[model samples]
Target chain A: SQTIHQWPATLVQPVGSPLSLECTVEGTSNPNLYWYRQAAGRGLQLLFYSVGIGQISSEVPQNLSASRPQDRQFILSSKKLLLSDSGFYLCAWSDYQETQYFGPGTRLLVL
Target chain B: QQQVKQSPQSLIVQKGGISIINCAYENTAFDYFPWYQQFPGKGPALLIAIRPDVSEKKEGRFTISFNKSAKQFSLHIMDSQPGDSATYFCAASTGSGGSNYKLTFGKGTLLTVNP
Candidate 1:
């Protein structure tokens, strides 16, 4: 069985601060990873996705960026956070079948 | 051409009643359709999925009806329970090619099954 883990389940950051969220998957290798943000009571917005290490694709242009530093480790980072950046960030992994499994998620609140 | 539209932004149903959510796509190239269920403050989980080749697929109390000609698909929940009260999102993708399963998700429907 595979499991996904995310850190800082919840975070409160002040405006103009930096942001970093990590996601790691176990029991699988060479899996595709994705980053998405869900606004309050709204649909999910895809931010970035990676096929392999050092390869990342941006679905939407914004202040956030994603990186696949390791086969099973993915990180979402931002040099400076904006008020609009506050939302529920999610990390997902998929195999050949492309059925994505998501992690518990990180809720960031910018004040 | 890559857009998926869903209806009924919110729904309220009685326990043991039927719950239905509809989704339509404009891109005929889309071959894969999936539905996800998300609880408050959590990530969406894959609930059921159907391909264009199948007209309908059922799993336990959940069913996915795919209409190839209509470019539409729907999810049906039988004997809905309070536990089923959550946000449902419908998504569609063109193919399973490497790094191409970019799913376009619907706005999501908030289902509340009253006990």
Candidate 2:
């Protein structure tokens, strides 16, 4: 019964603009959260993951940053967006070997 | 080091045919293997998964064949349909790390099924 939500479903921003994408999970508590970016026809690249509040592990070092202020709330942010930052962003939650359930995803377009 | 490697950057198959995608991993610690399906504009969804302890596991038209000794796993889609056309990803992870375990994914394979 666990569900994940992400927004804005789609985004368009000019280069160098600040960005913020939010993800939240319902029907589950204390689940591991992850942020992934996937380019068109490409595999997912793990950006960040958190096991609990205030515990963020970054998988890739880039212009983006992640924060876990609450147990089920995760935010992906960037001070200045780059053309390369545009892609499909996904938020997920998992427990043990159970499959990770992904949200609808955010399609970011940086012009 | 990249722990997992997936082959066939892309594949095309006709309806009712079979689609096969392969993946290999170097880390022996990986016990859980999973296959994910992604549409053009959607996040990857968990299609099926197999644990190293099981040689094979099936769910509907999708199956996962795992080879523990070879450190390899594969996804087989029988009776392929156009709706199955999408990007497929193979991922491996170990719960041995407990709460810190994170999935390590392969580059991915793109599958296209034509009617």
Give residue A15's error in model 2 in angstroms. 1.2
- Per residue, candidate 2 scores C-alpha lDDT tens digits across B22-65 of 99998898878888888878888899988888999999999999
lDDT measured at residue B91 in model 1 versus the true structure, 0 to 100: 95
Worst 10-residue lDDT window for candidate 1 chain B reads B93-102
Q: Best candidate, DockQ-wise? A: 1
Residue A102 of model 1, lDDT score = 88
- Candidate 2 residue lDDT tens string, A1-111: 888999999999999999999999999888899999988767888999999999989999999999988889999999999999999999999976557889999999999
Q: Looking at candidate 1, what is the lDDT of residue B39?
A: 99
Error of 1 at A12 (Å): 0.3
Clashing pairs in 1: none
What is the lDDT of every predicted structure here? Answer: 0.92, 0.90
Candidate 1 error regions (>4 Å): none
